[model samples]
Target chain A: MPEYASILFSEVLKILMLLVPVLVSVAMIVWLDRRVWAFVQKRRGPNVVGPFGLLQSLADALKYIFKEIIIPASSNKVIFILAPIITMTLALISWAVIPFSEDFVLADINVGILYLFAVSSLGVYGIIMGGWASNSKYPFLGAIRSAAQMVSYEVSIGIIIINVLLCVGSLNLSDIVKAQENVWYIIPLFPMFVIFFISALAETNRPPFDLPEAEAELVAGYQTEYSGMMYAMFWLGEYANILLMCALGSILFLGGWLSPINIFPFNVIPSPIWLILKILLLFILFALVKAIVPRYRYDQLMRLGWKVFLPLSLTWVVLTAGYLMYFDLLPGN
Target chain B: MIAHAVVFYIFSFIAIVSAIMVTTSRNTVHSVFFLILDFISISCLFIMIGAEFLGMIMLIVYVGAVAVLFLFVVMMLNVAQQKNEWFVASDSSSHIPIGLLVSLVIFSELLIVVGGWKYKAELQDSININLNLNLTNTQSLGNVIYTDYVHLFQLSGMVLLVAMIGAIVLTFRKRSGLKTQSYLRQISRERNEGVELIDVETKKGVKIDA
Candidate 1:
């Protein structure tokens, strides 16, 4: 029994280790987004808090912690509270299967991809419930729009994932990254790569696809009623998801943690540097799009998801299958 | 062993209570929230069963999509007021006959199915697949769907496509007096002519037109 206890304890510790970096990275991303936005507009962002705004996220955390939570008079109190927790928890839960380094994963289940996709899909509930429980029209409208957006884009996302699954033959994240060590899927599957990146942006509800929270329309969307720490939870969860998507894109297409700079003398810089660099590049791409593009209208966003991305991804899936079949390289064959 | 059993019992107890709350809650939104709790319990059960795929699907699909849809539609709907009749439908005289018939049918069906099932409870222990190392279920499911169930799958896709198109056609209406931007016309416009400058001076007594 003590032996079993020790095993469980180690597992818990492993999970906590993986979680710490992800949470910290999410905080860093918040700072990075603000800084990038400031730089684009030629203004200094968060310079007062700490050196180059390093401690800004910490100060914000403190602010959220100390602020009073306001529950609306007519709102369902229990659900209003539970909604943000659900969002935060679902967002964090996927970290269990995410491989931060080559062997540094909390859990390595066979269905890790499915697990990540599933948890991500489940995040909509938190938004919907937050909107419904607030008993506000704007939140309700935001919830409805977000739900439709999520479902529409999710199909394309699934197809893009299926494209990757075809090459790897396993749903494990570690295996997927390993399969790309020799040659990243991006070389052979560039079209699908583009589709996946765009679908991911939509899936995370980032700008210009962030119609759910369009201030001109929905007045802050599903999170209008959330304040203090609960509001912070949603914000953290959104950043965490962005980090997760960047990591996933790196793992799938960019050869995660594999050295793109292959000069022999500096090859010893550790694999995680390559991984971090790749993820950072993708993150910058996301921020660049936000800075450059205008917010899309709701109907236009839906058209892009369903009409453009879905068909493109589905075509890529069929093409991948055909290529694999021609080479007789498919699993089980 | 006792501690594990105790924890399981506690989780199961909470699950049952939450499920009861889901059905009985007066507030529709509250019911949906309880449903989410019920799904979390089922996910826990899936973790126990080593069927993480199905468990996560329950979370992603039922709790995430369907339940959210339910809550969204329910919250938006305005319910009519009516007198409370909580106990009127619960009288034994009104329920016993229907309850007996349901139990009898369910029991008989369970007996027949259980008797015919080839696999035994003991056999399942040795037949269990390792959750981490195995790669059989999802792959095989995909294989069969692509091969044997190809027609059915394609048919389902067509159905979904038709339904989606039908929805788009139904909801898409061209409003009167709404000017829409034309892609071709916009693209073909000469840049120099697209914008024209008009000069005018505005002053209370010295306004002039050019």
Candidate 2:
């Protein structure tokens, strides 16, 4: 009993250790996204807060906390309130299986990648529920768009992940990272990597595929009625999901915690730092994509997912399986 | 073992309650939400019983994709306002007793099966594909599915492919009279075709059309 208690206590401690930094990083990511956007648009972004606007996100949090949460009179109150909580919780929970380095993950379960996939796929629920519960036409439309969009992109993402799994042989995230000790999967699976990245963008409802929350037309999309902390929760959850996608991309393709090169100088740096660097680099690319690309039309987005990415990734999966089988390099063979 | 039993009971209870709510909820959207809850709790039960892969797959396929599709249809059709009057509506009053009788019969059949299984527990041992405790759930599933049940697996994949193609064919339409940008025409334009230079007289405009 004592041993069990100690294990439970240590697990809680580890979760705190992982979560605290992640929450802080989510805040910083929000600030960084704005600053990056401002730089691209040739404007000074949030210079009044702490040095270089480092504390801008904190100020925004405080502002949101003090603001009144206005619930719509005709809305379904329970589901309206539950939506943001679900979004925030689901966004944070996927981190349970993400390994920063060896022995760093909270839950080293066998189906870690599937757990992430499952949790991320369920993210549409929050948006759909919020939109539906709002009792408005725009939010309902937004929810419908989100449902179709997420479903379409997830098919291609599943196929791409299958391509990776064929090479790795295990669903475990750590095992995937370990398999890339000598060479990253990105070198061999470059096209799938690109598809996965773009799909990740679409999956997270980022710019260019953020049709769900297209502010210009849908008037903030599913979040049309959300206000105050509830709205802030949605914001935080969005950034967290973006960060999660970046981490997932790095892990699946960029070799997780592995160094770029296997040389002495490259290998000396710590693994977790390498993972962090890769995640940041990916995040920068995410932000830059947001800055450069125009928002996709709904039909075009659907076409890209179903017509282009779906067939391309499906073919890649077949090619990958054939290559592995031909060379007798399939794992666990 | 105590904790395992406790979690099992909790998940099963939630699953049962959500399953009931799924059928009983008046709001169609609420029913879909309850259905999602039911799937999630059942997946939790599966996970507790050492089927993590199946549990996560349940979440990914059913709660994630299927339920979202349900919500999409519910919202689009504006069916949330429909009052769920299963047996109470005036026009539907005649089928109430028959429906109840049918449900009772099914319930009793399930009860009989469970009671029989409890009495003859040894009969359950005759299963062809036994769970191998040595391998992870996914690994064992892969082994059996790829080798022993390969044809069935391939057949299911073909079924899904046919369904997908059928859905696209049913919904796809080629609408005429809509103006769409032709990339070839846009890209193939030359400077000579687009531009015309002419010397005009002092006050008269050139007849460009001619």
Candidate 3:
């Protein structure tokens, strides 16, 4: 009983260790995204709160917390409140299988990547529920858009990951990272990497494909009715999900926790730091894409996802399988 | 063992309640939400029973994809406001007695199956496959799926392909009047073809070709 108790305690501690840093990073990411947007536009952004507005996210959080949560009178009150909680929970839970380093993952399950995929695929629920519960037209439209968009992009992402899994031969994320010790999958599967990154952008509802929440048209999309902390929860969940996707990209393509070059200075830094650096670099790319790329038209976005990316990723999967089989490089073979 | 039973009971309880709610809910959207809850609870049950892969896939397929599609259709059709009347409507009143009788019969049949299985140990011999405890659920599933069940898997794939093609073919419409961008024309246009410089009087715009 004592041993079980200790196990439970340690598990809680580990979850806290993962959750706190993730929550903090989510806040910082919001700040970072704004700053990046500002830099792209040649303007100083959020410079007043702290040094270079370091505490801007904190201030925002405080403001959100103090504000009144205005629930729409016509809305399904229970579902409206439950939607953000689901989103935030799902966003955070996918990190369970993400290996920070060799031994640091919360759950080193067999189907790690599948677990991540499942959690991410479920993210559409929050949007759908929120939109529906709002009892509004724009939110409903936004929800429908998000549903179709996520489903379409997920097909491509699934195929792309299957290509990686073909090379790695294991669903365990740590195994994937370990396999990249000699050569990152991105080196050989460059096109797949790019496709995965773009799909990740769409899956996370990032810019260029963020038609679900296209503010100009949909008035913040499914988030139209949300306000105060409820709205902030959605925001935090979005950034957290973005960070999760960045981590996933780093893990799958950039060699999670692995040094770029095995030279003296590069190898000196610890593994988690390497993971963090890769994630930050990817996050920067995400922000840059948001800044540079114009938002895709709805039809154009659908075309890119289904017509272009789907076939491309599917072909890559076949090519990858053939190559692995021909060269006798298939893992477990 | 006690903890396992406790968790199992909790999940099963939630699953049963949510399953009931899925059918009984007045709002269509609420019904879909309850259906999602039902899937999630059942998946949790699967995971607890050591079928983690199946549980995760259940989550990915049903709760994630299928339920979202249901919600999409519900929201898109604007049917969330429609209150479901199971037996209250006059025209559907006859369905109430029949439904209750059928449900009762089905429930008894299930109960009989369970009770009979408990007493007849030899009946289990009808089952051909046994769970391989040594391998992970995914590994075992892969082994069977790629080997003995490969044909069945491919058949299912073909079914899905046909369904997809059918959906596309049914919904696809080619409207003639809409002006669509031709990428090839846009990209292939040269400076000479796209531009024409002519000396013209400032007041009289060169007769633009209609």
Q: Which candidate ranks first by TM-score, i.e. highest?
A: 3
Would you estimate the TM-scores of all the predictions?
0.84, 0.92, 0.93
Error of 2 at A323 (Å): 0.8
Model 2 fnat value: 0.96
Q: How would you encode candidate 2's per-residue C-alpha lDDT over A225-276 as one tens digit per residue? A: 9999999999899899999999999999999998998889998998989999
- Residue A295, model 3: lDDT of 94
Each model's DockQ score: 0.57, 0.83, 0.77
Q: What residue runs in model 1 are displaced by over 4 Å at the alpha carbon?
A: A261-263, B1-18, B80-135, B140-210
iRMSD per model? 1.8, 0.8, 1.0
User: Which lDDT tens digits does candidate 2 get at residues B1-210?
Assistant: 888888899989998998899888777778888889999999998898789999999999998888887777776663533444443478578877998999999999999998998899567564565656778889988898999999999999999999999999999999999987666798999999999888888889888778
RMSD of each: 5.0, 2.9, 2.7
TM-score of 2: 0.92
The 10-residue segment with the lowest total lDDT in model 1 chain B = B79-88
Ranked by TM-score, top first? 3, 2, 1
Worst 10 residues of 2 chain A by lDDT: A139-148
Stretch of 10 with least lDDT, candidate 3 chain B: B78-87
Candidate 3: tens digits of C-alpha lDDT, residues A38-151:
999998988899998999999999999999999999999999999999899999999999998889889999989999999999999898889889989899889889989999
Query: What is chain B's TM-score across the candidates, in the order shown?
Result: 0.58, 0.76, 0.80
Best-to-worst order by DockQ is 2, 3, 1
Model 3's DockQ? 0.77
lDDT per residue (tens digit) for residues A1-333 in model 1:
898899989988887877888899889888888888788878888877888888899999999999998999998787799889988998898878877668777787878888888888888888877887898999988888988898888888888888999988888888898888778889999998898888888889999889888878888999998889999999998888888889888888998777764678657888877788888899988988888789988778888888788888888889899999999988555
